[model samples]
Target: MKFLKNKITGITIVLIVILVALSPWIIWHFKPDRHLDVLVFDKTVPQNNYREHKGFIWLLNSFKYTKLNGDKYGLLDYFGFFPEPNYKYKIKPLPKDLSKYDLLYVTDTYGVYDRDFYGTSKNIEGERSQKIYGGTQSSEISSIKSALENSNKSKTLIVEFNSLASPTDTKVQKEMDQLLGLKWSGWIGREFKTLNKNNEEIPRWVFRNYRKQYGKEWNFTGSGYVFVKNDDTLMILEKRKDTTKDMTFKFSPKGQEDFGIKREVGYYYWFDIMEKVNNTESIADYTFFLTESGKDKFKKFGIPTSFPAITESKIKNHITYYFSGDYADKGEFPVVYQAVGLPKINSLLISDYGNTDSFFWKIYAPVMQKILDNTYEKKSSETKTASIN
Candidate 1:
């Protein structure tokens, strides 16, 4: 009977310790919602592709942001995620007025592809199909422009990669470039764990284009990087021969202070090669550890050895940010917005390379959380000043 009593007492003490340790998280989980007014626009939310904007959605939930005139936690103006009941309205148009939104987030403008729409196997397909749908519409770009130009309050704009890439109209893309201080070089690239022809992970078009341009059969089979321009110009950099190490996100000292990220993180996905225009500031850069031969290859193609990973610009009272890579893509994982210390713990456990979750938890979420918090603080201060006046 005494042993039983001691066991029960020990269990109770353990529970108490755990609860004490999680007290801060428990309080945070139940903090009152801030009710931030924001907009999210993504044209590539296909049925099976939830990762495109999953990290963004998780952030929204973390802040308890709500849809306009609604209590829902997510977007009412999203597109391409669901099958359109009416074919005439397949493409979703932007709200007529966006001046009321404190923040505008354009996560993707790449839109739906033939492979995604038709459910084609990810393996190589026939010559590029012309059946892609949706893109950054001219009217949508006009709406964003009007909001920036006419809004009475300070507005913040955030855009991710592929916003000015293929499927988006060139004229509309150029307009966005001017607004956000960007100049797209028309090249997109990604790292492949293996360059073997049988690797289903590699896109078929990349292999086909290289073979056609050089009139040589696909021969190399090793880890490498593949780059393709809008005009089908192909460049491949094999590991060891061209690059000594994987690419990493090298943050500027200012970026580290601003975003509260102190460590370099690996980025192994699609990214664009673009130049910063106007008064844009680079917050971080994609550092490619290329060999001398790799440098020669990039120089031959008129590409730089390194380029901006994140850029920021200020227009009047409005601020805009351009993420040059898939910064918001958090692969399949359960949301844990209420768990405060999980990201810190996870960052310590996960490796920095080839892990999407690590990048999301260690880099993407922290930077975005800092941005949202700072934007809200500034907005609140402005509100208080306006009220006083």
Candidate 2:
């Protein structure tokens, strides 16, 4: 009798400890303060990467609940979360319903993988899969554009990261111009000048030497911030520094020139796309401050850099148009678009654990936070207008 009692007590104690260990999760799961329905579409959601992805999602989710009043938030994962819980997490596969959700969060890489999987795989047929996987197809781009434009509900917002590829062969420069009537220089022969902490101009040659040591071509031109807008409203904020220099023309300079060569310097431009949006203007109204040390480092290294930090008042002002780079180089240059804004979305894009802690995050998160806040405000205003009518 005594042995049986002892065994029962041990089992009970273990059960109580297990419950205590899992208490936080249980509380978080069942006692959400607000209800928010968010959809995440990514192919690697079930892998270890999902944990990091969830960190961002949960950050946003917690912020949403704290800022907005909601008791229930519905989350849908397309690729699913790893360490698959014993309990279902309301997972939905492709072709599932999306109309009921309040917001959709999509990563650009997810779209690319989906296109290759469902669109290229012969196992599936018809245009349905193709439509879902918007690729370099006109129809797909148009479809996505239409969907975004139509999602005007005050409660719905689309937070997209690193997903702004031209749907067809049309470059983003051309597409942005056509879609928003904003003229932008291509990524070449641009110049970027750095300033010291005292706001004094750093010698241009300093950047020149840095570019050389980094094996970058010397063709650089002018570098600065490019602002775009429609009807006096700021739509896009592009802060970039470019370098353009001339070197001796090499044999087959037209094709053999490398990004590091002076001849190629005139042919290629490096750019980083900081923030893009529609309907809002004037990034100046927001408090703008880039880490002074980072700026100083760029100057010390003679690297071209641009930082967009503005006062809250500047954000409300209207911005008309902006330009970045435009140069012609051999096709070997790293795709400027691929390199730009990489750090801004690294948690979702890069597989390496080291990238998350990289400098990109340090500089980008604050900027993204400001942009997201602006977007949320804009969405709220639009919703109010619709509701009033």
Q: Quick one: best lDDT, which candidate?
A: 1
> What would the per-residue lDDT of candidate 2 be over residues 1-389, giving only the tens digit for each residue?
99999999999999999997766556555643433455444432322234324433434443343334454232234333222343223333333334444444443322322332333332122122232333233333343344445544422322232223323244643453343323222111222232222212322343444455555643334333222111111111112312122211121221122111111111112232333344422232111122455355445533333321111111112112221211111112112211223334453453321221321233223333443454456555766788899
Instruction: Name the runs in model 2 displaced over 4 angstroms.
Output: 1-32, 43-48, 64-76, 79-99, 110-140, 155-161, 165-168, 171-271, 274-389
Which ranges in model 1 have alpha carbons more than 4 Å from their true place?
Answer: 1-12, 21-25, 67-72, 75-81, 84-89, 120-127
Q: Count the clashes in each prediction.
A: 0, 57
* Ten residues in sequence with the least summed lDDT for candidate 2: 325-334
Q: Which pairs in model 1 have colliding backbones?
A: none
In candidate 2, how many clashes are counted? 57
Backbone clashes counted, model 1: 0
- Per-residue lDDT of 13 in model 2: 100
Top of the candidates by TM-score: 1
